[model samples]
Target: MKLSHALAALIIAWFAVFGRIQAVTLEVNQGNSTCIKAELTASFSITYNTSNSTRTVQVPLPDSATVDAGSSSCGLDGNTPWLVAVFGPGHALGLSFSTNGSLYSVANLTLQYNLSDTSVFPEANSSDVVTVVSSSVGIWAPINTTYRCLSSATFGVGGVTVTFSNMRLEAYMPGNDLSPAESVCMADQASTTAPPTTTTSATTTVTPAPTPPGTPERGVYSVNNTNGTACLLAQMGLQLNVSYFSQSQNKTIQELVNVTPNLTSSSGSCEASSATLILTEGRATTLTFTFTLNSTSNKYHLSALTLLANWSDMTAPLSASNTSLNYLRSTKGRSYMCNTEQTLAVVPSFSLNTFKLQVQPFEVTTNQFATAEECQMDQDQMLIPIIVGAALAGLVLIVLIAYLIGRKRSHAGYQTI
Candidate 1:
């Protein structure tokens, strides 16, 4: 009867141990304020005080979700908990706890899970409540529940959180930094126009001045002696009839011909009787004459003379004699010498026939004389002077002859007394 009681106690203890191992719980929290729809993950740890038996745990997951176990030896250590890796779409997680233990021994069990699958959450919403339950404890537990999208989880400053919509995350890895957004529009531009151009021109002008007038004119001529005729004598007077653009006019030109006499008898004498010529009106023209006398040949000829006269038919002849117009036989008994002179005159109506007078053999000589008009002006020049001794001798002879006649008359008176 005591063995029976012991066996019954062991069977009751085995059932109680099994019940404790089957208790499990799960919970979730999506920590947000906006509306969100997303999945949740629950991880579990199981603790059991049992011996000689194995327990198995099952954790329910959402459709299309997965479950995986962490290393089994992790559950053996009291501090190392078991892990249930969960993946799913709902806001709740599922966990199952199981263990192996002996009968009639008091056994205690604890369950632990890893809530790692966070991708099932709706990325746009807020946090919501999550519940956990255990059949062995007959209780529902509340945990602070939060949901996270795995793709949107960010790790910062010792914790992890879901990145919100419209919030940009810029991360700096080892190589390059993140870039910022750019701007859109631009500003306006500026404008201008040039001023109008101008042009100008200038002109200049000039002019000039005037002038004046000038003087008058004149002429010249010469006379020459040629042929055997004597040269026109120096101081010989002549008559020229000249006309220039007018009626003919007459003018007296002085004869420059002369003779010098040498007498052998005290009573013998020679004189200049005539040396002149007159021109007739129609017969006075251009002619020239050379008056030279050759006593040895007894020939008297006139040199060809050119006269500046108005008429072409003018002619004249030159003559010389011992008396006024007659030849004297007694003048031949005395020796006579002759010479010539040259003269010039310019009259308004006169012309000159010859321009020069050339006397050849240069030694043939001539003498110059004053004109007959010049000679008549001074009579003292015409008279010859007597010597003082000759005058005294004549006076003495007259006085002596007068005194002898007076003495003869006085002696005849004394004889009568």
Candidate 2:
């Protein structure tokens, strides 16, 4: 009887161990039945905040067996097309189909990433590689970076978020801290998703993303697309501003641009973005616009999208009688530079809803604002002369008082010199 009882206990223990082993196998690759390659989808894009370097990552389908369906707006990183810049594992990428549309889905995921693992990425352990994963980008600089991924990225903090995974992650350097255009590298094994462009035939009607409160519904946007690689010369004030709606986010943003750019006469900072432009003349320059659209008939309404730079100039203020238009005409050797490009109304009526600009805020080289510390320093600098003058006055007053006391003592003394 004792032997039979012992034998039965041993059998029960063996069964419990076997069951545990089966459960462990189910959790492999996040419970993926079969590992499948990742693909790029329209729902993928990258956006960076100039204010903060907090990157919100959503990529890499956990399971190749199950794929999600969705789309996102992705094109034009400022002037350069997104496909040309955002590529590979370093930048944020979007993946679509999984294992050629298998019956699997990434039910849940717990991404364990060391936010600040900045050891040179893609552990290419090929003897000459280093990676640095950084949590706080304040310290790490994504130097000599290249943007490459399988799919394109949208502009202006795009709204489309995909459920699947696989793609790249870009560097997050705040406010030109480290090469505004540079991209941060991603570590290997982390970038398990490859660049594969595959899509489903399902048609998705995407609704516009929410807009900020008080955003204008319509207007022509000015942007800085033409200031290719030109450092901003000076800053001027803009009295007039133009605006456009971003289809990705359905929000209106300010920008500067000309239907037909007269680069010679455009002064200050004439750069373009999808949504905003800076036609700053570093000095106050009154921008005037006039256009003659040759419609088949004479049914054309002429309007002007005049942009007046509103910022103060480092140099002398624009003349109260503003001779900027006259100056541009003389310098560019062109007549009618002041002929009023458009009438008082916008050149293209908002009703037409054509002619909009794009804004790759990350790619914007100009329109930069001074930091708090920098502004404080400027204040200190301006007060320096005043401080020196006050010190001199105090010294002179002390000297004067001393002289008066000395003269009084001499006058009172019996012996004089």
The model with the greatest TM-score is: 2
Leading candidate by lDDT: 2
Please give the lDDT score at residue 412 for candidate 1. 80
After superposition, the stretches of candidate 2 with alpha carbons farther than 4 Å from their true spots are: 1-60, 65-374, 414-417
Displacement of the residue 368 alpha carbon in candidate 2, Å: 17
Model 1, CA-based lDDT: 0.24
After superposing candidate 1, which stretches have Cα over 4 Å from the reference?
1-233, 237-287, 291-300, 303-306, 310-400, 411-417
| Model 1 TM-score, 2 decimals | 0.17
RMSD of 2: 25.7
User: Over the stretch 160-274, how does candidate 1's per-residue lDDT look in tens digits?
Assistant: 1112111111111111221233110000000112235354465523222212111111111112234433222222223332432211212223221111111100111111221
Q: Candidate 2 at 94: error in angstroms? A: 6.0
Per-model RMSD to reference = 82.1, 25.7
**Model 1 worst lDDT run, 10 consecutive residues:** 182-191
Q: TM-score for each prediction?
A: 0.17, 0.24
Error of 2 at 398 (Å): 1.0
